[model samples]
Target: MPEPEKSVRRQEEVLRSVNPVLRGWAAYFRYGASKRTFSYLGWYGWWRLLLWIRYRHPHLAWKQLRRRYYGADRITEGGVVLYNPAKMRVQRYTFRGAQISTPYNIDEVDPDGARFRRTNHDDVAFVGQVSEYLA
Candidate 1:
């Protein structure tokens, strides 16, 4: 119960920080029960805003979308956005096909030779320096 509340609060904070319009829409949509009987204008408007953002602001929308791929071959210059910090890992790949040669964490593997940088945010980490090991 508390976890869901925390998640909602975090989402509200991010949305408010990014755009106050979204915060207002979220508030109205969540509490517009009285207005829901006549028309779902608030609900419809929120979905439209989300779709608009998805197409017009892909980079910003990426935070809402998620993808998972194993190994270094899939690693991009943008690096990996680890939503779950518990899965922090260093990936080493072969130069030929860019396939992973090894996958390890700080505890299991020494990062001296990996050449990576980990940037932590509220609940996610943007790991850069992928080319060093993938090269």
Candidate 2:
């Protein structure tokens, strides 16, 4: 989606334009249940790139395009690596449960008063409980 007119550019140039956006998207969504979404994004990116390559080299076959762009385990062209969203590791936030300190019970939770105050303590506790139960 980032490089709308990359059909005239080289593979490395297109990758340079697209990788940053892909990296940012993956980073923003990594801290949630986003594995499936990441996989779909990766597949969609691959398909779009392949289509671009086909447009660029209409005379070449799919095998030639694959050999030119894809490496053994990753997509690489002109020494530039293509960012794959599926490679991003999903990290779900851990629920501290009762260990989490709230503004009302900050003194009880942390005797040393090192923790910050949480304004919406009830909402935070409910979400944490639900996440913990689901996990």
Candidate 3:
């Protein structure tokens, strides 16, 4: 059985350090009666936290301090939030596409291990270094 009240307050501190909206979103997404529990509200809060982190605390994207302490990716810049997996969550997974960015890889393998490549891609080029923004 899990220990009672060992949940710690460090996450609350980190959440407090962030913006109000991000903090609220993280609380709504990452905290619950059960870790496995999730709903549309939780997912929405998750997305908001990520954007918040990406825009505010980009440093966390690499070695996420909040994630390390809380074992959750409940916050991010510009408020795009996500539930960082820990414990049993490793057995469950979900994938989401990004709107502001897309994979740049020109080649990838299919689920069957067949190689496939991208072609006739748009000539439209975004003119800034994506890394710098995150940095």
Candidate 4:
């Protein structure tokens, strides 16, 4: 592959790693030489996986699929930030420019991952608010 082509492929790999399911399914749809056209399969696969990614995707950069909450400073250009309250630490780590998988907050004051996953589910808490911007 040319240098640019290699770069694009590497970028795709990074993206797919962040969002394993959508990218995995999209890779399945593509065939032969057409698989190189990652863009085409990407669009369709995201639709299938957006809800999963938004509400419940795990592992920002870690590919083990371990259960946890993940996010990016920006959906477009930031690295993944893994949040795990059980561990009693909110780590702002970097996972490159993969798709953003922000975690939802359950408590108004104590926003934590496992707590958010359990005792609360306010869709509005996660969207269309100043908090989302701050997050």
Output the number of the lDDT-best candidate.
2
lDDT of each: 0.37, 0.79, 0.42, 0.38
Tens-place lDDT per residue, model 3, 1-135, is: 986875443434544554454435545555444454434445555555445445555656544744542334534333433443322221323443332122443233342343333323342332233345777
In model 1, residue pairs whose N, Cα or C atoms come closer than 3 Å (at least 3 residues apart or on different chains), thus clashing, are: none
Q: What is candidate 1's lDDT per residue for 1-135, written digit by digit as tens? A: 455453333333433343445334444444333334213443443444455445654675454432322322221224322122112232333353212224334344344444542334532323234445566
37-93: candidate 4 lDDT, tens digit per residue? 454444444333334454444435333322332232123323532211122222234
At residue 107, what lDDT does model 4 achieve? 34
Best by the TM-score measure: 2
Q: After superposition, how far is residue 22 of candidate 4 from its true place, in Å?
A: 8.9
Candidate 1, poorest ten consecutive residues by summed lDDT? 80-89
Clashes of each: 0, 0, 28, 0
User: Candidate 3's error at 114, in angstroms?
Assistant: 69
| Model 4 pairs whose backbones collide | none
* Superposed Cα deviation of residue 122, candidate 4 (Å): 79
